[model samples]
Target: MSEHKPVPGHRADYRHFHAIQTRWMDNDVYGHVNNVVYYSWFDTAVNHYLVASGVLDIERSPVIGLVIETRCNYFASVAFPDQVDVGVRVAHVGRSSVRYEIGIFKEGEDSAAAQGHFVHVYVDRESRRPVDIPEAMRMALAAIAVG
Candidate 1:
């Protein structure tokens, strides 16, 4: 097996943040939160930001973001009842797609326990065709764009 290198991310690296509470069911047989739960957290954090920013309206929006790709790297284990602070940043924004980088940190910790990214392609909800990001959405994305 090959050794994996951890992607280091600090709280200061992100421009936005969202807090997630872990439930008792989040823990698996191994006594730590399951790996799959991390992905859910990622989705929650990003969509929440978009909705709160008035860029995404799940039910009424003509333009919607569809996740096309996702990846994650885990460096530590977290159990139930632990609050997670998710750091969010836009790594890249294309004409119809945006790459969102996220860092999951244990509450009050400085460094991320896990880090990953998801790419979302903006598309028309009805036609399912790629659409250019709206100007307002573009501006919102720029606010979180990272180097």
Candidate 2:
């Protein structure tokens, strides 16, 4: 059997997008945004969406989503002084976990410069045990779900 390889996704593949401005410090000695910075963008994009949708209260929410896994693939390089847009979509939403796919695109570009995913497991903030996703959070996630 042949394994399926990941490919860059287009803007239409995602349901939501968040804009991020790259800082000069994001660039590495090679003059391109460092690979590690892309991961930060993924976290920022997803959290920003959750907060903007009114489903997450970072300071007081009883449940929190903690990243359990993350992976990324880069097709092109991006640098500082560029505004990038990150597209987000939910690939899977389990009772206590969600698989979120993300894409980073240069301003006005149609295809992603990088694509990645991260799994967030919802857990009780105090107990640190897995918990069912909140209804409001589920609803917000539904808005960005994909097959």
Candidate 3:
């Protein structure tokens, strides 16, 4: 594997964004948002976009995306009172999987507090077998594809 240095990101680096409110429970003993909570934000940002784009129906879709891999790099800390702006973009799209890159920014900040990516493989909801991405999903993802 290649060494991936934790480089901070900027808002302009992402294609879309969703506002996420940090809950008090999200903070750890350090008084900042816990590392695990960032992953939840990542999931929320990506899934929300998919659902809003009409590409995903969590309850009724025959095909669903299953997270296959994920990673995050924290550059700074965020607190409960902060409104996190989660920026999302598609780094790559494959036959059955898509790599979604996410950036968590403290509201109004130009630089990202955290940045990372998760790979989701589309699969049969019942059979759990990999399936080609649907046309609607492909189009939606393409809209967010990063150069």
Candidate 4:
């Protein structure tokens, strides 16, 4: 881990939040939520936000954001069936890519159970080439940037 550690009361510059319940299968042999599942949570958080914000029309949008990179830091163990709250923020917004950072916490708890980040590069639906972020999307992402 880095010198920096996530602590209680830390709020991400997230415009919205969503609650997710951990499923029993989310755990691996050791009894803690597996590392892989954390990444999925990151995806679910960002996608759900975009979908609800009307920035993404998963089925018919002429534009799409593709995952270009990802990273995570697990500070503590979270078990299955636990109520988890996710906080998200836009760390960086580029011409065609946006970097989203997320923190996972146990419901009713303060500090994050884990933290992670992922970058999504928006591109043309058909060409799959990078494209400038639409104004609407930019506005949506800005709402999530940490001050």
* Local distance difference test values of all predictions, in order: 0.94, 0.97, 0.96, 0.87
Cα lDDT of model 1 by residue, 1-147, tens digit:
998677678999999999999999999999999999999999999999999999888899999999999999988898989999999999999999999999999999998999999999999999999999999999999999999
Clashes of 4: 0
Better of 1 and 2 by TM-score: 2
Clashes per candidate, residues 3 or more apart or on different chains: 0, 0, 0, 0
Worst 10 residues of 1 by lDDT: 1-10
Which wins on lDDT, candidate 3 or candidate 4? Answer: 3
Off by over 4 Å in 2: none
Candidate 3 wrong stretches, greater than 4 Å:
1-4
lDDT of 2 by residue, 53-83 (tens): 9999999999999999999999989999999
Model 4 regions lying over 4 Å from their true place: 1-9, 12-14
Model 2 alpha-carbon miss at residue 43, Å: 0.5
Residue-level lDDT of model 4, residues 1-147, one tens digit each, is 568655543444445577999999999999999999999999999999999999999999899999989988877789978988888888899999999989888887767778878999999999999999999999999988865
Q: Write the per-residue lDDT of candidate 3 for residues 20-105, one digit (tens) a residue.
A: 99999999999999999999999999999999999899999999999999999999999989999999999999999999999999
Worst 10 residues of 4 by lDDT: 6-15
Residue 35's lDDT in candidate 2: 98
